[model samples]
Target: MTTIPMYDPLSPEMISDPYPAYARMLEERPIHWHPVMRAWVVVRHADCVRVLREHATFARDPGRTGEEIPDFRQNVQMMDPPEQTPLRQLLVGAMRSQDKDQLFQEAVAFLRGRLTAQEPGEPFDWMATLAAPFALHMSAALLGVPEPDDEAYAEISHGIALRMDAGLAPENIPQGDAARKRLNELGESWFPRPEGDDGLIANLIRRADKEFAGSHYIRNSAAMMFNASYGTIFAMVGNAAHLLATVPGLLPELSVPSHVATGVDELIRYDGPAQGTSRTAVTETEIQGTRIAAGDSVVTLLAAANRDPLVFKDPQDIKLDRRPNPHLGFGSGPHACFGSEFGKLSITAMIHALRDEGLRPCLAAEPTRRTTATVRSLDVLPVRLSR
Candidate 1:
């Protein structure tokens, strides 16, 4: 067996840019046990697909691996079917009730207002002013809840993101704990809500059956949906904006209405918000000739899988119209992202608004990235918009 290189997710370099390290791992150890993470790392596209799709062999809940997980982590994404199926259906049904065109128009108006507020020649922080607020607005619309204060939302979301890394970085536990507490409090306020309400939370509360009657189940699930919706769009738009500002030849392609949807998929495949997610082996499984015993932890490097050259030709380059794109940006199988359509609509709205306004963004200053491992986010993105 070839020796696996040390993989430290918290390393500053990895936090800033992990694709290089992921490439090396994919080239050498497609699937191997990592002593530090105490899990098998699966990097190749085919292998990662196998791990995500085969729910019978690989379970979403870490508890199956004999590791005790906090209750907050037990949202629908962490469950396996038959338990996962009905909850997913409920969430999906609630989401379908959202007005896609109306939401898109709302997003466009919101972005236009933000863009117009900034002077043409002056640089403004895109992430703080535009990306985050746009995401928050869309999230509130989807949940049928009033928009929360941006500062408070930022603090809570940051803590939750940090909490995700608590397993790998022990120092984040306290912040994660605080975030969890705040989230629980927030979830509580939404309850005793009328089932006749139009928001996604109300829909879930109304449709919840005896199995999901537990207070924690609905609350945590709603919170999960809100957070995931906010964070994904925030990161995605920021990443896309950065590319549109810096990458050559992208602006023209994406400006076309027909290409906007295709471009969104390309952006997700290129540098999606989620870096990776873990699954536990319920039964002994072999991936690419490597044997994984039951109860072993397996981490699928999703960002790496999306860029695997064997599946995506010219994987490093951005092809806005790339076809047969089977990217795992939203994952796959039983646990695929529940808000993918909504996410796509929100992202497409931003791009289309920019196109209509003839707004071309250029980087004003060097952008900084967040240090979190699980959610790849931008700390600050400064841009100067020109019409």
Candidate 2:
């Protein structure tokens, strides 16, 4: 009998910096079942990619198998191919012809105005004031939420993010429940008749009315959209800013507006906000000669896979001009992130505005990191800016 290597997913060290554990897995036990988490961790670049792409072998839809994660019901990310097809098409088409250039310009203008209005010396939570708000507004505008003011959107968005980070803990369950209730209420109130339908929520409602007239479907779908747009976008902005501060000379390269757009990919690859994603195997399978049984959960470490030496030479270094950069930052396969372009555009806009405003960095403070079973992001980033 072959001795299977052991790994603990809930270990403190693994949570803080999972790369070491990932490396160990890649080297010795790339497909071992983790007894603690009751999941098989797929760590190598090749295996991760294969698992993501091959939906037949590794299932995304937990519902199909009567599997349920209390927090992730009705999420598009949890849906399999055929069921996900129509919804994915709707979202893709909504943002496909979007004028990214114009959007980026507007984002830059907005950021410039906000940063310029702030006093140079006084400390402000950059994540709260700048990155988080900017991401929320962008998502709100794109999703067609009633963006009355920056603060209003930020408050709702932040509340939702905090609720998600808390992850169904006894103390946090109320917040998540409250957020869902509030979002549903907002959706019902605003999308009553769809007179001024512009955002994604309105579009989804319209589609549902025209095609599938069901209250539960529309409400759950809208809630899922909110989770994706608000949470992921916030992470992208915060993570990019944090990376720019830590990586030497990366900011200067990003100063060029074109490079800002191009470099967003590199930033995501280097330190993507999404640390890992979970899937469950439906049948017995052998991945890289390691057998995994049916009904076992699998956590694919995308961040670690992105840094695999076999796939990317000098994997840790940031190369802004890396061509053919097929990083798993946006994930892969049927459930690949639909909002990837929107996220890239938002980050590009912020970087370009910072450069165009001739902003100089005054001080770099350590970023507060938010860790979870899935997403990774900065809780706060402190930066003094000079114009």
Candidate 3:
């Protein structure tokens, strides 16, 4: 019987490239218990799916472990069914009733115009100049924030991302708390107590009663929106570009809009932005004959599960037209991502715009990955754009 490696969630190497370590963990023991973190890792597809979908047994509340992952407070992502349902409904309804389709088209046009304005041969940090800014701007627009220039928007969004990516560390806690306060102040100033449902922010305020609605709720919701919009969406763009650039004959295939959307989905499945999510066991349970005790943390490795051969054939290979690609790239069950559609649209638009400009990514330097235990993303994807 091989002993499971004591995986340190905060290790730089683990954040840089976690797949190798994940594979080893899965191979050694699918349900390995982490002594240091006091967490149980679920690396296989079936196990991850079960844990995420079985909310009754596994809870999303980090506070259950007596340790709250920093900045997760009051966010819909951490809430259970009764609380989560209404919040999700309000958000989804607002998105649907609003002119989001038009907004998305406008965002795409803006990106294309900007890309066209750039010098043909000029090399730029695509992630910084294009991917990150575009995501931040689109998100701000979606949430009805003031239309700041892409650079300014990116700066604020980057700050928020830094705070979020820090997770629940003591040193980073102060920064995250400060950012949250700043974000709340900004949201209040920008969208000050509208009389009617004017925008996303206004809608959130209206939805909240005197009891449930307040400055804190509004601010935390905005922060969550910004994090989802900027962090995950930015990483999606980088991952898509990186994957397309490496795959033989894939860039050319993304010339069409439909193909662009399909390719984006494949990239998400192949190298999702969020590698895994942790859930705490609410009660004693047995998974695949492995006994799990209450208060145990289970980390579901989504990246590993996406590549599980049991669920996907040739899972490592990118298939642009992969049909029935039931991947948990957006997660599963009640806690599934609420902004999946927006994310897909953002990625597709960016890829299509890049393809239209005949821009191909030439890797200038190896990607510098963001340091986080739960998410897999690149900090700086240095690439030279070429025709």
Candidate 4:
């Protein structure tokens, strides 16, 4: 085995196409100390799963071990087991147990509405034309945000993502901060007096005191939830579209609901929103013979973990219905995405809507990827819808 050269995620080459680097790392050193990132990089599927599953050993907040991972900055992502448990349970439990299929149909309807708005034979950037709007609206609906304010919230989410996805650029810090403040304010104002159908906001208000400190904490948690799925879902929609357009026969196979459901997992497994995540080692630990000191920052390489050949057969190739797929694209354990199922439903809906509309979208030009260390999203996708 050859030694893989140390590479930074912020580098230009990695930013444009990171799989090669990720592949190299998987072969040479699955787990090692990242000098640039100042974290222990875990790339293998099993190791990453261990890191995510053993919550107490590798704490998200690391407060128990004297590591000060702030909650205001990361919200639930920054919390540990006992603290994170109730909050996670509340959100997950709020789902309508019996109306899941009904929810799915509603989601499909919402996506079709957006996909049909595009004119055939005309070129449009998929990112802006459909992906962003659809994801943002769904996110707003999940948060129980009202109509007029949802649009404004989307803009705020965009600013926050610009600041977050790109490592919080120097010029973007203020905008991100202001967006946070406004979102917190919006959450506080809207949650106490939710109108129409009850959703995330109402649920948060109902359970805030039990899971969180107070209304102020609820406001902050809402801010993190607001920024979490909104933009990432936008990126995933475009990603799946790109794959469907580029990969032959995928468009047809993925059109089927069962296939679409499975294909959504493959799409996310192939190029999911989260490339990697940072966690602090709560205690002295050893992963595959490598010793990790307490307080070390562990960067779980989710992107690399998904492609580990040891776990999945033909990991590189995109097979629509790859079953037994345990990709860490959505993180794992306590820190897994709160709305993971909803994301899959939304993307599947996007595919069905596009296929149903006879909208065969093709990439007109080379799409641009988001230039960020953390965010792996297409900046723009120039697509032409056709017969």
Candidate 5:
């Protein structure tokens, strides 16, 4: 194992492609202290798995640090079991009960509409016109909520995504809070939700009493879900599309349904948006010979772990048909992403729709990435579609 420099997420090199840095960490410092994150950076696949799964040892609650909880840490995403379980069950059940076929059809139709408007051979910003609106439409359909105005939705999405950075950049706290407030306000309008099969909201409202005590919890949880759905799917779709456009032969290969069904997971494993997530050690624990003390923060570099050579064969290359692909594009354990199914549906829908429509999109220019560290998303992706 060869050691390199300390890991830094915000470095310019990391912003463009973090995998090389991740590869270095996996081989050299699988678990070590990170000054920027103020946590022990865990890069090995096995170690990241352990950190996420052993919730009793590594808790989600930031309060374990014995510091005042930050504003960004107040939501359902930051809670542990007993407190986290019921809300998790309700949201997960609602997502599961969703008519996946209906969602898929709707997604395909929405994407087709956007693709039809694209001028062939003329470059267009895919992130703005297609990915953002499509994400909003699908998430709105899932929640059974009226889609907010585009301007408002964009502002909120940007803010909430920035909030995740508060751990590293405290200046983001204010903007993150404002975005969360707006999302909550949006969630508030959905209720007093009528009980019916309308969407996830109705399902949540009907089961709210059993799941949690207050409307506040339900509202915040629902808001969190909507934000996650729109923002996460937007990032995932954009990232996947970039791969299709840039990676040789991937577009044609994944255009097939059978291949894409498995390939979507590969895309996520290659470049997932939720790059890193953290947990606080509740008690002293040892990982790969490194002792982590109670109250210390352990940041799992999920994107890095996904490409660990020990776990993934030819870890750097994308194998669309790769099986037994136990990648943690989504975090594992008690807090695994609740919207994982929806994400897969959206990506597959985009690919299948493009193939059926005879539209092949290729990158017209280099794509630009968002400035944030925690969430790896595209800011601009220029492409030209050809029939």
Candidate 6:
């Protein structure tokens, strides 16, 4: 057996750039048992794709096959095929209802407002000022959070994120607990909205059967909305902006819609915000002859899979024009990021906004990153708007 290399996804060095290590792992032990994370980290693109698509053997929540987790069952992402199929179909219908052109226009309108108001020579944090608000507004609309209650929406989102992502510190768990309570209460109000309503909250209400007649599904589903949709978008757009700003001569390509779309895909493919996710083996399984016993956890390193040399040509290089790009940035299979369309549109709008007037780093404060293991996010990014 080849000696599997050790790489801690939580370490600060990994936070800066986990790709080089991931590359090594993919080449040496694509199915290496990572001691630090205590799971077999699948680094190859083919293997990750299979793990995601093969929902039968690899269950999202191992508890589902054994003991039931009430909250986990409600989360569509944490569900398996036979159970999640119907619910996911319903969500697909709702997602299709959204007008992509309208979304693009809305994104442009919102981002242009922020960019126009920026101080020419000074640095401004893009995440708080633009990315957060843009994502918050869009998520609010999707979750059916009514206008004029920004505080409630914010609190609910923060609490949901803390609970789902384990972002809350031990001492801060109380705040998250309180926030979840608030979200449950808010669900009550949202669940009673008219049947004709289009927000995700209302949509979930309409789909609820006797078993799910209330906000039980709504509250948990909202977490999925935040994580896969709004939160992912917020992180990716911000990260993409920071990366794009550093690239020279790409501003012109942003003006073209085809290029913008492909650019967003490549940007996400190269350095997407999603760090990695884990799944549990339902029964015994083997990959490349490596045995994975039932109940063992397997972590899929998405960023690593996105850069597998076997799948991508010149894997290290970021080519916006890269075609046949089947990167697992949005993931794959049943639990793939369904909200990817909206995210792509949002990124395209960002590109166009920057194209109007080029952007440069402010040098006022260096960009900083959060110390998170499951996701990569920026703490602050300062950029100067240039015309």
* Candidate of highest lDDT: 5
lDDT of 4 by residue, 92-171 (tens): 66533224455557667876776677776677898876887777777766676664355686678767765653332467
- Candidate 6 lDDT, tens digit per residue, 1-387? 666456766567886778888888878878877654467888888888888888888889556568566453355676787877776776666666666776677777887888888888777897777877888776666556664265566555555445544422344456656675665555455556775777665665566665654535545665556545666777776788777677776666655667777778998998898767778888899987899998877888889999888999999987888898998888898899888788787888787767655654333467777655566777677777766
| Better structure of 3 and 4 per lDDT | 4
What lDDT does the true structure give each of the candidates? 0.84, 0.69, 0.72, 0.75, 0.86, 0.72
Clashes of each: 0, 3, 0, 0, 0, 0
Report how far residue 133 has shifted in candidate 4, in Å.
0.9
- In angstroms, how far off is 79's CA in candidate 5? 1.3
Worst 10 residues of 4 by lDDT: 94-103
Clashes of 2: 3
TM-score of each model, in listed order: 0.94, 0.86, 0.87, 0.90, 0.95, 0.88
Ranking by lDDT: 5, 1, 4, 3, 6, 2
Of candidates 6 and 2, the better by TM-score: 6
Model 1 stretches astray by more than 4 angstroms: 1-5, 67-72, 194-196, 210-214
The candidate, 4 or 6, that scores higher on lDDT is 4
TM-score of 5: 0.95
Error of model 5, residue 119, in angstroms: 1.1
Model 1: what TM-score?
Answer: 0.94
Per-residue lDDT tens digits of candidate 5, residues 1-387?
Answer: 445887777778888999888888887778888787688988899999999999999988776557676553466787888788877888787778788999999999999989988888999999998999999999999888888898899889999888887778889989888888888888778877664556878876776675463547777788888888899899998998888788878888887667877799999999989898889899998998888889888889899999999999999999999997999998899999878888899999999889878887789998899888889999999999987
For residues 36-144, write the lDDT of model 1, one tens digit per residue: 6788988898988888888989998766667786776667767788877887888888888777878888888898888888889799999999998998999989888
Cα lDDT of candidate 6 equals 0.72
Ranking by TM-score: 5, 1, 4, 6, 3, 2
Which residue runs of candidate 6 sit more than 4 Å off their true CA positions? 1-5, 147-185, 194-196, 203-215, 357-364
lDDT tens per residue, model 3, 1-387: 776457766678787666677667666667777665566778789999999989888999666556654543566776777667776676666665556677768777867886777677666676877777777778777787765456655555555555543434446656656655665555556545556546776776676666555545546666677667777878888877777656777787766656666667778988888888878898999887889998877878788888877788887788887877888899998888878888888877776677666777777667777766555667787777678
Clashing pairs in 1: none
Scored against the true structure, residue 74 in model 4 reaches a CA lDDT of 47
